[model samples]
Target: MSKLEILALSGSHRHGSFNTALLDNAKRLAPKGVEIKIYEGLDKLPFYSEELDGDSIHPEAKRLREAIASADGILLAVPEYNFSMTALLKNALDWSSRPAGRHVFVGKPTAIIGASSSILGSIRAQLHTREVLHALQADVVSRPEVLVTQAATKFEDGALKDETARLFLVQVLDNLVAKINTSELIKTASQEKAS
Candidate 1:
C-alpha cells in the first residue's frame, strides 16, 4: 500500500495563527511512511447553502471535498471563538459534509488539537468539533488529546516552542495514523468476507 496521507486544517484564519503553526509542527514531526498536507483556502470557501449545493456549488467547496477525499485521514488544529470552533472551519466542514453519506469525511479517521491564549485552551471548541465530526460519521481518534493553553508562552517565532506541547502533538498525529491503519485493515477484512 502507498503511504498514508493526512490533510491538516487550522480553524483559525488569522495572521500568524497558533493553530496553523500547530499543523506546521505536525508536518515536521510526522513519522516515516506518513505525510501531512496542510490545507489552505479556508477563507475562500463560501457559506454553505443546500439550495446551491447541487450543480452550481462553489468551486472552493469542491476543492475542499477533493482534498478530503484524497486523504487517508484528517488532522484538525482548531482555535476557539466564544467557546466554540471558528465559523470558518465549521463552514468548510459543512461544505464537505454535503450530499449525505457520500461525503469524503465519512468513515475517515480524524484527530483534533487546539490552542488558545487563555488557560482553558480550546477544549470547548474541540469538544464541539468532535461532536460535529461524530455526527458526520467520521472515525475520530479519542486518545492523547493535545490542548496548548496559554499559547503566548508555548509558541514563539511562529512555531511550537514548548517541548511538552510538541511531544503531545506528535503523539496525536501518531495515533491518527494508527487509527487510519486500523480502519484500512477492517475495510480489507470486510471486503474479503464479502468475496
Candidate 2:
C-alpha cells in the first residue's frame, strides 16, 4: 500500500531533447501510488574507470548507485544516435554496474521507453538498452512498448500531446508497477522458504 518510487534517467542532454520530454510525460502519466523521480547529473558523471571506482568512488557515480538502490523500479528514456544508444546513457549504466558483484541493478524492475524525431522512434537504442539491462540482471518490462516515432509531432509545450502515445505511456507505467510488486513478492517468498 506504500508508494512505489521509480528512478527515471534521460539519455539525452540536449536542450529540449525528445527523450527528456518523454521522461517528463512519464512523470505526468505515472499511476497513483507511484512516484517517478527524474534523475539529473548524468552529464556530470566522469567516464568509468577502475582506478576512479576504487576506494572513493566519484560522488556522481555514488549518487547514481544510491538512487538505483533506493528505487523500486527504473525507467529509461533512451535516444537513438547512429542506430545506437547515446554514450551518456551507456556511461550511466557502466557506473551503475560496478565492483563485479556490488552493482545496484541486479534483479531490479525496469521499463524502457523512447522518443525520436525519426520514424524508427529510437527502437535500436531501446533494444541495445534492454540488452544491457538484461546483462546487469535487471528485470525489464517487456510489454506495452512505448516507441514514439516522429516525436516532433507528438509534443506541444514540451509535453507529450499525442493521445495514443499518452495511452501507451500509461500502460508502460502500470506494467512497471506490476513488475515491482511481483519482484517484491518473489523476494518475500524466497526469504520465507529459506527461514
Candidate 3:
C-alpha cells in the first residue's frame, strides 16, 4: 500500500505555542509508514467573507483545500480560548468548508489533539472542534486524543518534553492511520458496487 499522508494543522498562531509543539511531537512519534505535514499558512487566510466567496477564491484558501484533498487524513492541534477552539483554527476550517457542500473536508477522517495550561488541557476546545468537524460531515477519530496540561512545563521551545504526551500522540497517529485505511476500504467497496 502507498504511504498515508496526514495534514497537520494547529489552531495556535503564537510563536512557541504548546499546541504547535504537540503537533511537532506527533510528527516525531508517528509510525514509519505514515507521513505528517504541519501546515503553517493559516495566518495567511482572510476572514471568511461572503463577498469574497466568489468562484475565484483567495489563493491561500485554495492552497488549504488542495492540501486537505491530497492528504489521506487530517490532524488538528487546537488551543482553547474562552472554552473553545481558537478563532484562528475556526477561521481556517471555515475557509475550507466554504461554497456549501463541496468542501475538501467532507468525508475526510480527522484527528484532534490539544494542549493548554489549564487542568482540562484544552479538552473543551477539542469537544468544540469535534462538533465543527461533525457539522462538516467529516469522519473524526474520536479516541486516543492527546491533551497536554500545564503546557508551560510539558513543552519547551516548541517541543514536547513529557514522555507520556509523546505516547498519546503516537496513539493518536495510529488511530488516524487506521481510520484512513478503513475509509479507503469503504470507498473502494462503494466504487465496486457502483460499477
Candidate 4:
C-alpha cells in the first residue's frame, strides 16, 4: 500500500501557537504509512473576492488550493477565537471555495482537532469548523476528536510531551487513517463495478 498523503493545516498564525505545536507533535507520531505535511501559508491568502478569481488568481491562493486538491486527506488544528474559528483559517477556506464549480475542498476527507488555554479547549471552534467543512462538501471524520485544554501545560518547548494528549492524538490519527482507507476502498469498488 502507498503512504497516505495527509495535509496538516494549523488554524493559528502565531509563531508560538499551541495548536501549531499540537500539529507538530502529530507529525512526529503519525503512523508509518502516513505522510504528513504542515501548511503554513494561511496568513498569505487574501480575502475572497469573485473579481480577483480567474485564470489569474493570487499566487498564494493558487498554491493553497493546489495543496488541498492534491491531498488525500486533511487534518486541521484549530484555535478558538471568541468561540469561533480564526479569520486566517476562514480566509483560507474562503479562497479555496471560490470559482464555485471548481472548489478544491469539494469531496475531500477532513478531520478537526483543537487546543486552547481555556478549559473548553476550543470545542466550539472545532464544532464550527466541522460545520464549515460539511458545507464545503467534505467527508469529515466525526469521531475521536482531540481537544487539548490548558495547552500550555500539556506541551513544552513547542512539543506535545504529555502522555495523555499524545495518546489521544494517536487515536485521532488512527481514526482518520481508517476513514481514509475505507473511503478509498469504497471508491475503488465503485469504479470496478462501473467498469
The lDDT per prediction is 0.91, 0.92, 0.89, 0.87
- Output the lDDT of residue 20, model 1: 93
Which one wins by TM-score: 2 or 3?
2
Q: lDDT by residue for model 3 over 16-129, one digit each (tens)? A: 888887888888888888888999879998898877666778888888989999999999999999999999999999988976798899999999999998999999999999
Estimate the TM-score for candidate 3: 0.96
- In order of appearance, the predictions have TM-scores of 0.97, 0.97, 0.96, 0.94
Model 4 pairs in collision: none
For model 1, residues 42-140, the per-residue Cα lDDT tens digits are 999878888768888788888899999999999999899999999999998899898898888899999999998889899999999999999899999
- Per-residue accuracy of model 2 over 1-195 as CA lDDT, tens digit each: 789999999999999998999998889888999999999989999989988896888999999999999999999999999998999999999999986666899999999999987999999999999999988999999988799999889889998888888999999999999999999999999999999
Ranking by lDDT: 2, 1, 3, 4
Q: What is the RMSD of candidate 1?
A: 1.0
Supply the global lDDT for candidate 2. Answer: 0.92
